[model samples]
Every structure is written in C-alpha cells, then in structure tokens.
Target: MEKWLVVLGIWAMCAACAVLFIRGATAGSDRRASVREGARAASRGSAGDTRAALND
Candidate 1:
C-alpha cells in the first residue's frame, strides 16, 4: 500500500508538470501573435492617425 501511494504521488506530479508545460506553450504562441500584429500596426503608421486604427 505504501508503494502504491508513492507511485500515485509521482504520477500526480508528472501530470501537473505536463499541464503547466502545455499552458506555457499556448501562452507563448498568443504572445507571438500579439507581437506580430503590433508590428504590422506600427509599420502601417496607424499610430499617427486614430481613424486608421479600427481596433484601437
């Protein structure tokens, strides 16, 4: 019974780690997309004109 408890604890830690890794990966992609969009908006000179920026 003691060995089983240890095995369960190890598995729980592994699952937690996997969840965190997946969440981090997803957030990283979102940050990359946001940066790309920001760059495009900056290059188009939307900052100079408020009318040109629809989402802002």
Candidate 2:
C-alpha cells in the first residue's frame, strides 16, 4: 500500500510538471506571435492597430 502511494504521488508530480511545461510553451509561442504582429503593424504605420497589438 505504501509503495503504491509513493508511485501515485510521483505520477501526480510528473503530470503536474508536464501540464505546466506545455502551458508555458504555448504561452511563449503566443507572445512571440503577438510581438511579431505588433512589429509589422508598427512598420506599416497603423497607429491604432499597432498600439492594440503591442498591448497584447
């Protein structure tokens, strides 16, 4: 029983770490995309749109 509990705890920890890593990875990609878009908008001189994109 004790061994099973330890195994369960380890599995839970691994699952939690995986979830956090995936979330971070996705968020990073999203941020990169937002920055790229914002830059493009700024370059195009769309003042209002660029402000919104950069704010993201």
Best lDDT among the predictions, by candidate number: 2
Q: Write the per-residue lDDT of candidate 2 for residues 6-50, one digit (tens) a residue.
A: 999999999999999999999999999999998997787877777
**Sliding window of 10 residues with minimal summed lDDT for model 2:** 41-50
TM-score of 1: 0.73
**TM-score of each candidate?**
0.73, 0.73
lDDT of 1 by residue, 1-56 (tens): 99999999999999999999999999999999999999998977765676656656
Which portions of model 1 show Cα errors greater than 4 Å?
46-56
| RMSD of each candidate relative to the true structure | 7.1, 9.1
**Residue 33 in candidate 1, Cα distance off native in Å:** 0.5
Error of 1 at 4 (Å): 0.3
